[model samples]
Target: MLLIAVAMTAILLLAAGVVAYVAFPHRGQRMPVVPWLGHAMGKAVNAMPTGTAPQDFYEPQETSAR
Candidate 1:
C-alpha cells in the first residue's frame, strides 16, 4: 500500500541520516585551537560589560589584591 511505502521511505531516510551523521569526520576534542579559544573567551569575559567580570563573577570566595 501507499501508506506502507511512505513509512518504508521515512525509515530508510532516517537510517541513512543516522549513518551519515555517525560516519562524518568531526572536530570534537581534536581541534588544535581549542586552548586558544578558551583563553580568548576567558580574557573576553574578564575584560568588561561586553562579557563578565572575573572578580565579581566568581566572588564569595574572593581573592585579595587586584
Candidate 2:
C-alpha cells in the first residue's frame, strides 16, 4: 500500500509538471508549477544557466555603415 501511494504521488507530480509546461510554453526557464521552487533552489538553479534568444533576434538592426 505504501508503495502504491508513493507511485501515485510521483505520477501526480509528473502530470502536474507536464500540464504546467504545456500551459506556459513561453514562461522561459521556470519551475513546472511551483514558481518559488526556483527561488528556493537558489544557487542550484543558477549553477547551470539556460535561456532562449530574444524575440527580436531576426529583426533588422539599425547600422551606421551607410
Candidate 3:
C-alpha cells in the first residue's frame, strides 16, 4: 500500500510538471531548473496547431478625452 502511494505521488508530480511546462510561455530561454526538459517542452508547444490567426479590425484614433 505504501509503495503504491509513493508511485502515485511521483506520477502526479510528473504530470503537474508537464502541464506547467506546456501552459506557461517560455520563449527563447530554457527553464532554470531543467534546461534540456525546457527546450523539449518549448518544441512540443510550438508543434501544436494554433487554430486561428489573429485579426485586427481597426486602428485606434487619437482622442482629446483622456
Listed in order, each prediction's TM-score against the native is 0.38, 0.41, 0.46
lDDT (Cα) of model 3: 0.74
Candidate 2 residue pairs in clash (backbone atoms < 3 Å)? none
Give the whole-model CA lDDT for all candidates, comma-separated: 0.55, 0.68, 0.74
Task: Please state the error at residue 55 of candidate 3 in Å.
Answer: 2.6
* Candidate 2: segments with Cα more than 4 A from true spot: 26-66
Mind giving the per-residue lDDT tens digits that candidate 2 earns over 1-66? Answer: 999999999999989756665555335566656767544444454576799899999999999986
True lDDT of residue 34, candidate 2: 76
Regarding lDDT, does 1 or 3 come out ahead?
Answer: 3
Ranking by TM-score: 3, 2, 1
Error of 1 at 33 (Å): 26
Candidate 1: stretches off by over 4 Å: 25-66
Candidate 2 at 47: error in angstroms? 14
For model 3, residues 30-60, the per-residue Cα lDDT tens digits are 5667778777777787898977754653767
Which stretch of 10 consecutive residues in model 2 shows the poorest summed lDDT? 37-46
Please give the ranking of all candidate structures by lDDT, highest first, separated by commas.
Answer: 3, 2, 1
Backbone steric clashes in candidate 2, count = 0
**Cα RMSD (angstroms) for every candidate in the order listed:** 13.4, 8.7, 6.7
Better of 2 and 3 by TM-score: 3
